[model samples]
Target: MSLKSTVIFLLSLITVMAKAQIDTAKIKSYADQVMVRVNIDTNIERYVFTEGPEDKPLETILSINNKTRASFSVDYKIISGTVSFTPNFLPGNNDNELKGSSSYADFRFRFFPKKIIQTVYYKKVKGFYIENMQDFFPEWKEGKDAYLQFPDLKIQSFGGSTAYVMKKDFSLKSIYTQGEWQKESRGSWVPVIDYDLSIFTDIIDGRKNRDTQYSIGASMGYFYNWVLGKKNRVNIAPNVGLGLGGMFSSTRDILDDGTKSSKENTQYLTIRFATGLHIGYNTDRLLFGGKFNVTSSAYNEKGNQNVQNNNLYGLIYIGYRFPPPGVVKRNYDKIQKKIPIL
Candidate 1:
């Protein structure tokens, strides 16, 4: 199906299923309060390229130098948003001499409409160096030898996902945003549809080259929240998802003579996997938590070349909940009156 048709179908399905009754006794909602959070995370984006025989393959791993990031987030009612950036002052994040300079930025927003969860995000990353230099240089030393760097390489991506909860008692929000809390342990199967558009640009021998890719996938995920403590203040949640999709990519390269050659609409099969675990302490006014997550996607090109994009991160966050100021609430209410979905 076309991408637009698929999106429409998913929205219709979500709207139909949202009318189903939910068990209020199993979950607690904090919609009347505003939540503000600060998060510190060790998130890294990496790409792996491999070729040659299956028994013995040649591999290259490209990664950025920044190893730490900080984010601020806010949530009110059904809406949540976050902004994140790499902090160069953090220890281990500013090794620019050996790894070349790098920059990263991310913005994300989410909406919860009953049993459906919707998310949209944008990310930009620049500069990368080969992390495993020893694989190519036999005499390379970790601290003494400088790895290969790509300071001109840049990547930007836009992506979103739509997910639906299959169980009425399960609370996905409790694990993701802490907008709610689950009083009892529960598990649910969630179906998700996700899509992305990405652009990659790099300069080689003073010539600029660009590639654009588009992809969409549908996946089934299983999530379980195990609530603990006598007061149900602590919880552990684990989830996993697997999916298959297709990637359509186009490339343009500047030739040595200053002419541009373009290749359009090359298609490849893609495989995706994601898993995460979250553990947190929750109360009516305060919350704190930690989480670890990994996501990966791989696709093969002609001549046995395989490329994989892998993201792995660990995050710790502390948050506080408070009543919204009267002016803020009044303004939100006025906006909601017109939109009804806020």
Candidate 2:
């Protein structure tokens, strides 16, 4: 039992099994150096106070990268912005004709985490329309040359939400949106004895009407960061938000003896708001941005009805910042907490 004490205990058990197999191959080469990025965004939504003729925006977005927080992100959305009206209804001294716009491509789910981060969402939207239908059916417009002309309409939506974030910028958002909207076009107001004042058209046949909505909301936001020059990374952020919620609406129309007239699903009370102005330019491997946003929604159903919708958008982004995946830090500089969130 003495061959140099068994060769120094077999060389201290082969130096502890070669330092535990070189720390399990540096933790499998730091989980195969994980670092992923992908993003695409395009937007357009504006009301600006509403007036008429001006519509074209279907919203499109795609993103990925939450490798446990790369500024957080996991979103995918496709929106059918809005605009459609063929011959739904017109009677108050008519004049209607203008059909060339429609959209539909439902599918939405979001989890945008930075810039005050924290957001969870779900949506199932469908063909949205109605921006300034003569400021909401002013008897289908009478005065100004009896205005009314919208084509192709059908809207639907589904929803879900959860949000919470603190300090790292500040944000609190909650949401839920249910939907169903429709449009119909038939004939009305007879008068063609021998006096030109034509007002009746349905190009390819039509008759459909529906409106239903369910909403919930909550908002509170703030973001502040102004780093510029001198390797400060040139970044600027400004944000604001407000919220209130309640909405339940239903309206169905179709009656000329075929009997079908509904409009009792009322439960309104809503207010939502948003504002943003952000600019970015980070390096270590590119990251650029230019964002300008303003949004609002107000609805108070009942006598003297009050409805409001205002949205303005602008967003351009380009990203790529992968260079930090190299570890096994040989004791990670004697361990000093470097974002290993666990």
Candidate 3:
């Protein structure tokens, strides 16, 4: 389906489930409060391509120079939104002398409707350099060598995921957004369907080229939230998912003579894996946590070529919850009456 149709379908499903109830015995709801959070993270995006024989393969890894990001988030009722950007002033983020400069931005929104979780996000990244220059050049030294850089390469992605919790007692929100607190240890088998549309642009040999890719996948994820502490204020959650999908890509190349080449379309099968762990301390008014997560996907190209995209990140966050202002609550209630899914 098209991106617009998928979004409409998800919104319709959420509208239907908006009025559904939650199990209050196993989870504590903080819908009446507004939660605000600040997060600092090291989220690195890398793409690795390998070709040649299985015994002896040639690999090229491309990654951005910026290594640290900061984000601000707000949660109210069942809605949450976050905006993140690379902070160049941080320690490892400003190494432009060795690696070329890069820019990154991400915007995300999430909704919790009863047993369902829906997320939508947009991400943009520009500028990449070959991270493993020594693998190809034996004489290349780490701090003393200048790696190959692609200053004109850019990637933009629009994506979302819809997930369903099978166990009513398990609270995924407690681990994800901290909008709810689980009273006891519980686990669930959550099924997810995700889709994305990505566009890649680069300048090669004085010519501009662009590739667009559309992908959809379905996965079964297992999540466990282990509650501890005498006051049930501490929790540990671990989750993993495995899935398969397909990527359909169309490429266009601009000739050096200022003519546009015909678009070429290709298809490939993709395998994806995701794993994460979260440890947090939550109280009535405050919460603090740290998390580590990794997501990877691989696909094979023609002529014995394989490509993989890996996203690895570690994050620390602190949040506070308080009652919403009267004006804000009233305005949100009025809007919710019309949309119902808000």
Candidate that would win on lDDT = 3
Query: Where is model 2 poorest over a 10-residue stretch in terms of lDDT?
Result: 174-183
Tens-digit per-residue lDDT, 1-342, candidate 2: 863564355345434433332211100111112122332233333223222323632221211110010122221111112221222232311222221233223233433333222222332212223334445565554334422333433333445444444432221111110010001111111111111111111222355565666677666544333345765455454555567777666666655566777665667777776655566654545556666666677774444344565545555555443433245334443342563421
Off by over 4 Å in 2: 1-41, 44-152, 155-207, 212-218, 231-233, 238-242, 256-260, 268-277, 281-288, 292-314, 317-342
What is the lDDT for 243 in model 2?
A: 72
CA lDDT, every prediction?
0.89, 0.37, 0.90
Which RMSD does model 2 reach against the true structure? Answer: 26.3
Which residue pairs collide, candidate 1? none
Clashing pairs in 3: none
Clashes of each: 0, 7, 0
Instruction: Please state the error at residue 302 of candidate 3 in Å.
Output: 0.2
Q: Score residue 291 of candidate 2 by CA lDDT.
A: 65
Task: TM-score each candidate.
Answer: 0.92, 0.25, 0.92
Candidate 2: C-alpha lDDT: 0.37
Rank candidates by lDDT, best first: 3, 1, 2
